[model samples]
Target chain A: MNELVEFISNNLQLLYILILAIFIGVELIKNVPSVLHTPLMSGANALSGVVIVGALLVMLQAKPDDFLSLGLGFVAVILGILNVVGGFVVTDRMLQMFKKKK
Target chain B: MNITLSIIYLITTIAFVIGLKMLGHPQTAKKGNLISGVGMGLAIVATIFLHDFEVPSINYILIGIALLIGSVIGYFIAMKVAMTKMPELVSLFNGFGGGSALLIGLIEFGNFSEDATQTSTIIAAIIIGSITFTGSLIAWAKLNGSMKDIRLPKYNLINNLIILALIAFGAYIVMYDSTNLMLIYLLLFASLVYGVLFVIPIGGADMPVVISLLNSLTGIAAAITGILFGNMVMMVGGILVGSAGLILTFIMCNAMNRSLSNVIFGAFGGGDVAIAAVGKTGGTIKKTTASDSAIMLNYASKVVIVPGYGLAVAQAQHVIHELEELLTKKGVDVSYAIHPVAGRMPGHMNVLLAESNVAYDKLIEMDNINPQFPNTDVVLVVGANDVVNPAAHNDPSSPIYGMPILDVENAKHIIVNKRSMNAGYAGIENELFFNQKTSMLFGDAKSALTELVNELKNM
Candidate 1:
């Protein structure tokens, strides 16, 4: 319980940031025209791939002989990269199709 | 935790916000996507270079290899996928993101101990991420037509029980034994099973809601993982995505005039309702020919095309674009009446039409085009059914009752193109088909539109 309280106090700033970012996010996404829903979704989907950083940090901290730890981090990094790359590329492809009237 | 990396993350966060803001307009949306991509790129580069990790060198090699393999596969898949498969691809990507978060949680749990907050966040990440991952896989399978809808009897009750059990089981782990690998594995297994159960009952047409919901789940999972590490960029980015997805899910539900709970629990489009509608005839389906439809379209001063899932199935977007061009050249004011839930996904029809080079201005939203239906000359419903069904508005007994739909019946003439007299995704008889103003032009959308275009050109 003491450790939990200590962690909370230490990370209070991050918690505030998380809450504020959510409000701003909802406000920003509220007005996106329906025509762009798919692209917008795909774009945000890519952003979730930020987990790759955590994967990298974990991989770098794992012991040299700890194959299990290393393997988990490695696969996580791959999946994260796939999400980041595929999401942005697919969103860009979809957005490219929305051309103005000639 | 370093000062320089923190500044980079702050910059990346701002870029994401600005990019999302720019996405509200069509002309700037592509550039907005590019800006976000660049921000992601900067974050990746900064993480690789600036992060202080005191591990062996082989790990770096493995990371490099993984990055290369993932990027190559991702790029090819994105480049090669047809526009019609966008939803499935997005679902697949969402699953990948969730899978990564789940793995992160597992790895972190192994590395950290004796910290209640960290343990709780790790468990939350694992549960949410696993559910998002497996749920998205089911959604992808359903979208691609590889999986059939399976609704066990009393599924809502069953789903509720499973959720309760999971909560109890997770609470047990958190309170009593957070270190038990066996219990954690069991929790993961249960979460995955719940994920499959969550999506198996949902019909394919309701995929937009499911996909959006899962997208948000993945974001929330990522956010929890960020909380585990106290990473600002991950925290902010994931929250943004989480909220964005929530907003879209609500928009999709509102567009259908349904609530989120109703969409998830109603099981409205599972094809069971069709049996109830069987042998209950509404009205006779009046058949029309391509030549007749062409003549009607040619003479009309204003025309609106209503498209749906079948239009994409028949791959008729190109021919439809040609038809629109032919009509426009004949001095007709042509536009599209796009219902919010028109295709398999949100803005699906717009993407299809845009791929065939249909001008964005010509694709009118439902609210803006609904009032114009009364003044419109002809409404050519190509391979669409449910959105134009009058039962939604008038038949209180209908499952889709109260759902806002295109007022195609208000037009002076209605020409519907379909392959058969079958019901749409909701499995209900469309009373609009039998309206005196409506005529069914039966055929595949592509061939029928091609013939209609030929007929109009000869006229």
Candidate 2:
């Protein structure tokens, strides 16, 4: 816990970015019209798939003898990849429907 | 090198926000999705080559194989699914997101033994992540029509016990020295059980709300993952999703006229009550033919079309679009009144209607269009039942009572197109169909609309 606090104090700039990011996310799109709510929600679903990065990082840092990490990392990597691939692709398909015809 | 990579990461973050902002507007939503996709791709590529100074020691071949396998599975499944099935597919993807986070948290829980805050954070992620994973899967199954709410004896009691146990276990793990692996594993499996039990009692009527809540939890889990890894992009991306999903869930709950707690614990329509309620029939409804409906539409000065899940089921989007166009050309004021939860998915009906090339401006929301229904000469309800049911207002015993519904009942002339007088998906008799102004037009929405088009053409 002390280490974390120390790290936070050291990386005050990144911490500010973190706090600012939340507001930018919350306030800017608060009034998303109902017509776009589902797509907006689904698009956000795709965004949460950003865990793929964290998952891959875990895999990279794991020791070779750490069978648990290897197995868990493998599972994490597969699921993360699936999430990004499926989420963005499906979101694209849904949004494509919003096109107005001439 | 670090500075260059950080710049790339910053660009990726900006791109995600821009994408979400653009996603709010109908005209630019598709473009927004594409923009975000590009941003995600950029982030992935940069991370692969840039982040760690030392080359990654992880087996590159395994990750490659896994990526290949996952991409193929995800790609083909998504492409193969029809728009009507999109919600199920979405739930599955949401489940995957949550499951992955939970898996990572579980692995990390034992590793971060010395740090109290970090350990607690990992445990929180595991609990939320597990709930999201299983809850999403249940939502998917129910949406897919493959699962139903399980009614075990003393179901609520058992449910409470499991929840208490899970919470107690989570707290214990955080306090325990070194966070024993055995306890962590127990926490995971028990949490999974709790997740299933948590969602199993909610009826299909609340599926949309359930899916939205689970989606947000997944977002929250991702945010927690970001904290654990100290990844700025992941944390921001998660906060965006988490915030957006919560907002959407709130909107949907308002639209459905139910509170989030009610959706979670009030034990909505399911099993016995739904069956018994549906078995109760409404008084005889007046029937009308396609020709009469066509004449009504042709002569009416204003028209409102209400589309629901059945509209997608019939694959009648094109026909509905054609009808709207024909009415427009004839100078009739045609608009759509969309209930917030109209279709299976959140915006499923809107997307279906849009796919048919319906004008974006013409699709109206329930709140905006409800008052307009009174002035409507004809309100055509196509494959929608629950949203238009007047029992939401008049019948206290109704499952969907006090729920906000469209004022289709207030319209001058109401025509409902359904294959039968069958109870709707909620298993509640839609009193809207039995309203004095309602006239039943029995047939597939597609065939009925097709017939109406043919009749209008001949006239």
Candidate 3:
């Protein structure tokens, strides 16, 4: 817990990046036309699967005797994996359909 | 410590941003998606192999198994699902994303669910994550037509109370020891229930808003988890999800002419069954058959196909493509007139038609196609109603008024294919149905299309 606090205090730069990322996200998405909203939704859904990072970190730090933490880590890992893999594949499948008014 | 790893993470972030940027254009979207996928692949690889890059433990076998199994399942599902079921597929995937984040938050709070500083973000993750997970499931079911709209006694009161309770309890947990593991897990459970209740009252037409809202909720969950993990890439990805989902949600709301807060809190629009009895309804309906409709198409010089959720429901995109091809062969100017919110999700109709190998050149937007309808010899409206309704333009008291709709009414002749004359998702009367220029062909869309194809052959 102390390490968590120390890391947070030390990593104030990352926090600023997170906030900056939000503004960039708002601007980036405005360019997406409404017709592609489903794919955008799907793509964003897959994007959130980035939580696989936190799940991995939790598992790595778990004590050998700690079963509950380990179990949660396993659930997190499997679900996270499914999310990213499934989301990207499905979104690509949908995106393959878009064409112009030729 | 590992400068190389940081560089790779930066590359991954650039991949994501650039991928999304290119996704805005139809010409470059597929390549953009592949770029983003590469970024994700890069992130996963760097995480697994690098020691100082993350925490200590490494189990190649577990990671390998999970990836292999998940990939196979995802591939099969994505490949096998029919175009009509795309909304359901996307909803389930979004649910998994949110559910994973909520579980991560719970795991974080294992030692303490509410420790002043960590409590705020962790709880945020759980509440938003759980809501997204269940809310998406409900929305998916409703879109799939498997679930009916549910309204409990005092639905609004119960919903408001539950939200208030969740907030108050969360604050209380922060103030107390937050030691009880039961309470932590219970919060997830309570929130899930709230999610289900939250979506049950929204009418079918408003489902795009619900689904998009759920997508944004999952994004917020991911963003909070990113902050908790102190990972820059995850944070960037989460922010993207949050903003993209939110933008999509707002677009849906604006198109519907409904306020976002009204859709979320008011739980507006009800009436479980569509106004099913088409014959007794007010306007005089001129009924036609596949053969007669086909004759009309056979003679028409120009035609437009207006598709809606019903087209997706009946998996008729392929047949519509075939019809379009046939019409083009006879020198009919064939192009689709797509309303902004025609299908259950954004770009849903386009994706479906693409699966059928329909030319994108022939698919036209509402703004561009409306003016062409008056000049069009025939407008073949299949499985759509509210978007083509005349009421949107003229009926101020109507629920869906001011909603921009396709100008199918102006076409010289209108041919609508449906199973019956039931009201559309908005659960209001579409005066377009009663228009004297309109002729309703009551039957399953797929079969009607198929029969129409056969009739065209005879011609």
Candidate 4:
């Protein structure tokens, strides 16, 4: 219980950031029309690949002989790039087809 | 955590917000996607070059190699994939994102920070990431027809028990020992099992909800990873995706008149009874030729086309466009009626039709078009069944009974094109096919539409 309190007290800023961002996110996505749902989904998907930053940090911070962490971070980096690139390219392709009334 | 990296992350966060907002409209969605992609690129470059990791000899070459391989494969697949296979591709990509988060959590565990908050966050990331990874792969396999829906006797009970056990085990590890690799692997294995079981019982008709739900899981996983690292860009971006996916899931469920829990636990559309009471349908099937249908379409004042997954399967979007043009030349009005859950995912039919150059304004949603059906002269249903099924309204015992469907029956004339009398993915009979005003034009969607176009031209 002491540890729980200590953790929350030490990280109150992160907690506030998380809560506020969730509110902003919910509000922003509420207005998207149904026709754009697929692209919206794929685009949001690409953004989740921001975890690649965490992978890079791990790779840089690992000790020279820590092969396991380095190898895992390397694979994570590759997967994150795949998610971001594939998601954005595909979303662009889909969005190009949606022509408004002439 | 340095000032330079912090400023860059803040810029990236703003870009993501504006980009997501721009995605709400058709006019700006493509540009919105490009803006967000630029933000991601900026974040990556800044992280590699400016971040102070303090470790000696960073492997720039290895990182460059990874980027090259991933980018080439991702670009080629996205470029080459047919529009019809989009849902599967999205599922596969989502799985890889989850895989990355899972590995990040595992790597973090190797360094095992003693902070209670970080430990809990790491556990959260690992569990959520593993579930998203396995669950998404299953959804992809099901969408691509590589696997079948497998339902155990009392599968929901089994799923619930596993979930409970996993939570208890996770809590135990967080409190007792956070650095044990064996316990972590056990947790991962159990989460993976739960993920597979959670998706397998859901029939193909409910794939939209499954995909959206998994997409949300990946986002939450990313956010948890961000919490562990205290990275603002990851937090904001992940939360945005998580909420976006949750909203979509709710929207899809509302369109179908089912709750999220019901969709997961109801195990609806088991195809064992595919040919349910065929003899009991009230009306006989009426067959019509393409020439007859074409003549009807040519003479009609206003026609609304209903395209389904079958349209995508037959690669008939282009031919349908041709038919639409020919009808227009004859002074007939043509538009498309789009059901919310029409294809495998939300907005699936729109993407397919758009790829074939269908105009955005002409494809009307269910609520707006349902009321106009009574005044419509001709309703063309191509390779679609469940969305137009009158049984959704009139038959109480039907599995899809309460679902909202396109009111195609109210139109003056209904013409359906299909390859056979087989049921749709939901495995339920469509009473719309047997209605008095309906005429069945049997053949592949592409070939049938082509024949109709040819017959109309010679007239």
Candidate 5:
């Protein structure tokens, strides 16, 4: 029973990766209208900042002795967050310039 | 601890989502940034408590010192650096990220033996990290003007051979489990050199594509590092970077009417040759007075303004905005046509225009504005060249042949505001100048635009 559980756990990561690869492939092949590309890309880049969450989780799960990993994870999360936030701010600032005056 | 971690992750993800959404429009980007910042802070706090290692005095001191130095330097650089240099700065930052990943992988490899599980991780990290590090460094050099934009002698064949040899050597070291780490280091060093050589040959005009490519490389490297460390977040983040970089690269390539392969292998350096090819018609160009041009502009029912790198160089955005205001007051419908690949970086013109408080609605992308040119009474080309060149449409043997261009010639009147009839950065003469409908208005962009503004005010 323990062996079966271990096998399943190990395979979970592979399955997740497969799903992600498929999503990326689909996105690439689909013809996104040119007008939407900039907005969509900006959106996607911002969403990519979601890695910070994973970083946070890893840090939280780190054992008491795993200081180096924890510290690195923290730094990653911080930087990732900054990227997401800064990117969004700049994007919005750009888009706002295009908005019709009230 | 698990709950805290989960919450932190959830927050980070939300921030990412919000940030991306905000990026789609300029209005909400600031809020998006704040959301992401909050998420980052949570992640940092969660990381601090993750491991219970007795804090080493020296390590803490080192971290503090590094942070202080980095922050101080970063602050000064950010404050002092011109906005024009932002793209190069971004490339440098990407290099640092790639370097970090490589350093982490090397450290990890030194501490561990190449087991079946570790083999894939180590190889992936080393290859991706090395590529990113070198590629970004080269990009930085190109942007900083440290390297010429043209290809070096026999660069194509030599670069390919070197890359192949390095890959083969790296594979051998990884497969054989040879305790000699020097071989792996050597491979990495070669790759770094190759990256610089590869990017150096690419011209300034291709910097946007280079930036996107390096960004993608950084992502791939980060992901590989994550895999080696069995870090789920790193893996996801890396993949994101790779995908985003690729998408941006594609967009930039499309804008240039060039393929990825062409951008990578094409020897675009012989700009001087292209310039010489322009028929030396000794006939001097007829120059228009600012007052005359302004009178035409003031009376026009509709006008389309096309901007380019020269506008950025002159810092004439404010004057242009004022001109737009004056034109609008005269009941002339005004709009701007923006080429995707204009300026040194992606969305560079937009940033400059926004800084000058130009209305966003007035700014239109190439496709949207291209169709509207026929009905425009006046087409004003401001510091723009290649994008407005008619050779793209008419000339078959032209280097920029088959590339899409703005149909500025279709307008009843075309006013080209440039310093002189010097060929653009691409070293190609704009056939638009020869068009019977076009008139040359020569002077510095800012001064010329300012004079036009003054004339319009008097009119």
Candidate 6:
């Protein structure tokens, strides 16, 4: 059972490659109308915040022996969290400036 | 360690997707950010509980120190940095992200033996991460005016050769299984140098494209790091970065009427105008006094004010606002015409106008107000130069030819406020100044607006 778990974890490398290939493929065809670019860019920026969630998962799954991984993962999670929060706050502030005046 | 944490992670991912979607519209962008932030906070909290045993005292101390230093510096910089400098600041932040990823890759490589798979991942991360870090730093410097706008000498050939050599060295190290990490370090340094060289030649005007490019590099690096560690977040994050950056790069290229290949490889040699057009026309311009300009404004039934970087430079938004209020009270209809890429960054004019408490309703974008210029009685151009230049409309041989322009010249009377008849960012003479309908009001924008305001009081 322990060997099986280790094997599954080790195969994550393949998953990374697959995902990257898909991303690049999607990007190549992302010639959306120019009007939608701003909204799309903003949406993508917001999505990039997912780094925090991934960082957390890595931290949780890391072995106690791999203290450095655990530590760096935790730090990444924190910063990623701050980025998401701050990004939202700033985005909101900018939007509010454009709100239709009563 | 188990299902609860997984659920939280899943929820965070959903939030990320939603936030990104919300970011597409200006109206819901804030809420999207809020939701994303909530997800991030949850993720952080989930992380703290994941580790089982007690952390060493030193590790805990280090974490605390890092957090404190980071937050304080981050908060201070965000608060102090002007909105005009925000894009450059963002580029700097992206650099930090790339730096972090590169460090992770280096650390991982140090511990892991040179297996085929791990070596490939490490090599990819080293190249991408190092390039992202160095490219972003040069971008930051250029935007902040620390570096010259011109391209560094022999930059293109040197960069290509270095990148090719690094990749070759990387393949060699991977294939040989050499413990000599010196080659890896050399690759990292070459990548870093290549990044700096790539961005230094890109002029300030093309900053938007450079920024997007650096962002994509950061994403690619992060994804490669994920491959090294087999982490889903890094991969997803990198994809997001790379895709978004590519999209933005395309948009910026369209905005400037240049192709991606042209933007990257073509060294933009001239200012806002083509160098060939210089000295082609040397017609004398008509000048007017503050009193005469005041008379034109006072008698006009409809006035359109075009504000630009000069207004911001003179810190004259407030005075302009006051002038607008005076004009409106006198029953002269007034509206402001704003160009899409006016000022340094996108929406720069809107921000400056908003800062001075200009009524949101009166501020009209270029497309909406441009057609109204034909019937306009007076056009008050305040410190605006390039965006209003008539060369864009009439002169085909002009560099900015075919680019859309505000039809300020269509107005029956034109009062242009400027310090002198010097050319704009394009460094070419403005034919609009020499037009028979135009009158140059030579003075500082803030002072001229103030004088106009004072003159209106007596009328």
Listed in order, the DockQ scores are 0.80, 0.64, 0.53, 0.75, 0.17, 0.21
- Per residue, candidate 1 scores C-alpha lDDT tens digits across B1-459 of 678888998888888888888776789988988888888888887887787667578988888998998999999999999888999999999999999999988888777846666778888998999999999999999999899899999999998999899888877777775698888889889999999999999877788899999999898998888878888778888899899889989999998998999889988785667677655557677899999898999999999999998899899999999999988888999999899889888899998889999988889999999999999999999988889988888877788889999999999999999999888887888888888888999999989989998999899
Write one digit per residue (lDDT tens) for candidate 5, span B158-273: 98998788767766766787667787677668877877787877777777687677767766776666666555545654675577568778877887889988888885524554
**Candidate 6 regions off by >4 Å?**
A1-96, B51-57, B112-114, B177-179, B269-275, B359-361, B394-397
TM-score of chain B of each: 0.97, 0.93, 0.92, 0.97, 0.92, 0.88
Better of 3 and 5 by DockQ: 3
Q: Which scores higher on TM-score, 1 or 6?
A: 1
Q: Is the docking of candidate 4 incorrect, acceptable, medium or high quality?
A: medium
- Best model per DockQ: 1
Instruction: Give a tens-digit lDDT track for model 2, residues B1-459.
Output: 367667876788889999989998878888988898889888777766676634345555556776788889989988899888888888899999998899889788767657766887798888989998998898889888898777677778898898888888777776765556888888888889888988888878788888877888888898888888777778888877887787788888887878998887777676666666674556879999999999999999999999988899999999998999898889899999888888876677888888788888888988899889889999999999888888788878788889888998788999999999877877788877777898999999999999998998887
Model 2 clash pairs are none
Candidate 2 residues lying further than 4 Å off, grouped into runs, are A1-19, B53-58, B271-281
The first chain of model 2 has a TM-score of 0.82
Put down candidate 1 lDDT per residue, A6-97, tens digits, no spaces.
87798788868878988998998887788888888888888888877777777778888999889998999999999999999999999889
Q: What lDDT does model 2 reach?
A: 0.83
Please report, in order, the local distance difference test score of every candidate based on alpha carbons.
Answer: 0.88, 0.83, 0.79, 0.87, 0.66, 0.68
Candidate 3 lDDT over residue span B1-459, tens digit each: 366767787898899889877777778888888888899888877776654633434444545666677667777877788767778788887887788888888888865454475787788888888888898888888878899888888898998999999988777777785767788788889999998999988877788778777887787788788777667777888888787778878888887777898777655455533343222338588998888899899889989999888788888888988999998999888999878788777677877888788887777988899889879988999899888988778866666668888989899999999888777776776778788899998888898899999899889
Tally clashing residue pairs in candidate 3: 0
Could you tell me which residue pairs clash in candidate 4? none
Return the TM-score for each candidate structure.
Answer: 0.97, 0.92, 0.92, 0.97, 0.84, 0.82
The RMSD of every model to the true structure, in order and in angstroms, is 1.7, 2.8, 3.4, 1.6, 4.9, 5.2
Residue A99 in candidate 6, Cα distance off native in Å: 5.0
Query: How much is A87 displaced in model 1, in angstroms?
Result: 0.3
Candidate 5 accuracy as lDDT: 0.66
Query: Number of clashes in every candidate structure?
Result: 0, 0, 0, 0, 13, 4
